[model samples]
Target: MIRVAILISGSGSNMLRLVEDMTGDHPARPVLVASNEPAAGGLAKAAALGIATLAVDHRDFPRDRPGFEAALLRPLLDTRPDIICLAGFMRILTPGFVDRFAGRMLNIHPSLLPKYPGLDTHARAIAAGDTEAGATVHLVTSELDSGPILGQARVPVLKDDTPQSLAARVLTQEHRLYPAVLRRFSAGDKTPVMLGSEGLVRGS
Candidate 1:
């Protein structure tokens, strides 16, 4: 079985979905859930789900990214995960830290990607009069949200949509897209999975 470690920085709705899906015939199992904030709510949730949890609080390093990552690496090295999932993990890892895991790390972004690569994606898409907004699961590279795409799930941008409204709908797609990508990815398949507003379309 593939040993997976999830990193989160907030409520971890995506993390929960990922964890819940790794069961029965799933090829991967969660080994740890670590966070940058000690008080992150996801830690409690992961613990409730019987997953080991850790907090390598970023504040302790005080403007030191490498130091923070070094501290974060201790538990991760001890756990020796085969895959790392960044589920809402807010920290921007340094190139050295990113290189440590390299292709084994994955992240789910809240936009179709190759489009809005960073924050405020829903708002940006709405402002630009986009007809569709969605999510992408991709390999985590040194660049911010610029990794090779693993899967994409698109949702319609409604006429009456606000950022919050569009985000809510897109989040539903994220919950589906990330797990689907992880399942295929852990099984050694890199073919991109695509989902439309309806459901699974085709691997493109």
Candidate 2:
């Protein structure tokens, strides 16, 4: 069985979906859910679903980046997760911390990655006059959102689409793509699966 540990910083809708997907006829299971914020609503949701939860408040650490990342490592090490899923986790992890997990970590980004790799992706896409925008599930590397892409779901950007409207559409795609990618990862495959202009493509 693939044991998973999830990290979240806000409402855990994506975490909930991952838990549900893993529990259904699959060997993957979420053993722990950790949050950097004590007030994160995902902690409660994880509790309700009978998943073990931990709150490692990032603010309690010293202001130095290394000290803060060291604090974050404790729960993750304790859980001994086979895979770590970053579900709306807000903090930018240190490179050392990211390397510790390496391919074992995954993150779902808001925009079809390699495009808008940072914050305000939806608004930025609209401003740039992009005709298509979506979400990506990728392996976590030391670089920010530059990891090997695992899966993606694209939505055409309509001329009438506002940032908020486009975001709503992309978020729905995220909820679907993230869980699918998790299942694929748990199955011991590292290949990339993507939806491109030519339909679904799997890359070595």
lDDT of each: 0.93, 0.86
- lDDT per residue for candidate 1 within 103-137, as digits (tens), equals 89999999989899889999999999999989999
The prediction achieving the highest lDDT against the true structure is 1
Q: After superposition, how far is residue 131 of candidate 2 from its true place, in Å?
A: 1.0
**What is candidate 2's lDDT per residue for 1-204, written digit by digit as tens?**
889999999999889888889976776999999998999999999998889998888888767778877776876688789899999999899888898888889999999889999899989999999989988998889889999888888888889998899998888777777887888789987666665433344352
RMSD of each: 1.0, 2.4
Q: Which candidate's TM-score is highest?
A: 1
What local lDDT score does residue 38 receive in model 1, on the 0 to 100 scale? 94
Candidate 1 lDDT: 0.93
Error of 2 at 201 (Å): 9.6
Clash pairs, candidate 1, are none
